[model samples]
Target: MPTPHRPSAPPAGRVDAIVLGTSAGGVEALTHLLPTLPHDFRPALLIVVHLPRHLPSLLVEVFSVRCRLPVHEAADKQPIQPGTVYFAPPNHHLLVDRDARGPSLALSADAPVHFSRPAIDVLFESAAAGYGKRLGGVILTGANADGALGLQAVKRRGGVTLVQEPSTARAPTMPQAALAAGEVDFVLPLEQMPAVLRAWGDGGAI
Candidate 1:
């Protein structure tokens, strides 16, 4: 396992949104993290989890029951709302775009990255571009290296970056790859993530 870095405080502004990416044990990992978020937690959450292209995703249904905030499958041109969680639908690349109305969700069927549509890199990179310093990127447990470069992009854009501690991950490749690719603000066990995120949502320094 890589040495855990001390948590770095984000720049002097509240984060407006967070992008989370995962695969493999993602459902279990998210269960541990999202359910703990308070109902009034600020900041919108956008998520990408690798799923079979042929199958419809049930993430919205699953999480809506478990989470305090509203959960939905992301839709093209959907307006982003704070305190909500949006999951990328299977077979599309979820992206963030800003227009006159502010940041909104965009979906694309462009070629897959790392052999996965709704690739973590796609979502992270686009969210970094759309939200810039107001974005937060998190790479969780996964079987592939899909989120590494995306997390780097987030860092490059002056956004906060975090990874699930590889030592505690069910499939450590994604988190380990993210740590190897660039510096991260935090590397934490799943049990500790909710508190950190709650702090972020509360506009408190990490």
Candidate 2:
């Protein structure tokens, strides 16, 4: 068997998709981040926020009112569309997979990891595999360590990784864990993330 050559790190402005993981303060964090993205922001945004599995998720409805992009709750086997915001639906883990047609979203009802059905790790790992160097992984405010290893996996694939600055996060544990993993490419305040994403969306430096 031959070793596969990994591509060089992608330019900050070359991001094709984004996968974000947050928990405890997710709604507030997303409220601040989504509305600030430029209307024409190009990369598709995928998100996972910890929620009760049994109840219906209203995340798409809530975010659609404020987000610059159209928001949709991910449905199983749906193709990922650019410039859209997709949220993991309650009770299922959202995953990204590449097929002959292109990248598509998948939903799984497997047992929970880190006590979360829609675990951040599940989404991050799958997106990292699907998008590789073109993906950008973000870890935001949360109380658990769900996203740490998955973010590291993104970095290992030469993808850019960002973590919220611990001091500024509503819950610092998640960001702190990712930072401790020693793979994050940037640590920034939440207020600055949307601008960075906007710049990346514009093909400008992040």
Candidate 3:
């Protein structure tokens, strides 16, 4: 796992990409957050929600209706398109490969980091490395510590980092872990996060 680095405020700006790792009580937070943005919002969304290793994830189907943009499972080596939401399904580890051209998803067999094949650190580190300062990471409600190290990576790379307030979270363990790690950029309740994310998504809040 990458070292923890947190900032009270991330430099004011819009991120080109947004990566979210969530579990436990994610549906409520995500449903609250996604529907607030316009259908054409530009930033790409990469999301991972830890699921039972053998079950098929229906998250994409469920979120697509709540989200304005098209939601789909990520395809390995497929180029990421703007204004779309991509999800990690079942047990595969989803990652991004960054080169001079840009970032694209890579499905990997690397052993689980933090005991999660779809580890939050894996996505955050790869995304931070791929998008650099233009990335954003959000770690929502979860029962475990999977995302703590990953959210730190996003902050270290100058990307925005946010945590759904533990008090507001249906499950507080993940948010509390993130808060203890460092002062995140936003410790807002789920209801208020969409505003910040929307403004950020559209190339800086106006």
Report lDDT (Cα) of residue 19, candidate 3: 94
- Candidate topping lDDT: 1
Q: Write candidate 2's Cα lDDT for 50-155 as tens digits.
A: 9988999999889999987999999999999999999999999999989999999999999999999899999999999999888889999999999999999888
Considering every candidate listed, which one attains the maximal TM-score? 1
Instruction: List model 3 lDDT by residue over 1-206, tens digit each.
Output: 96553554343446888999888888777888887878878889999888788887888888888878999899899888888898976688888887676788889877877677788878888898888779889989988888888888888887888898898888999889988887588888888887778767765443
- Can you write out model 1's per-residue Cα lDDT over 94-127, one digit (the tens) per residue? 9999998899999999999999998999999999
Q: Is candidate 1 or candidate 2 better by lDDT?
A: 1
Model 3, poorest ten-residue lDDT window? 4-13
State TM-scores per candidate.
0.93, 0.93, 0.90
For model 3, the stretches where C-alpha displacement exceeds 4 angstroms are 1-13
Candidate scoring better on TM-score of 1 and 3:
1
Off by over 4 Å in 1: 1-13
lDDT (0-100) at residue 121 of candidate 2?
A: 93
Instruction: For candidate 3, give the lDDT.
Output: 0.83
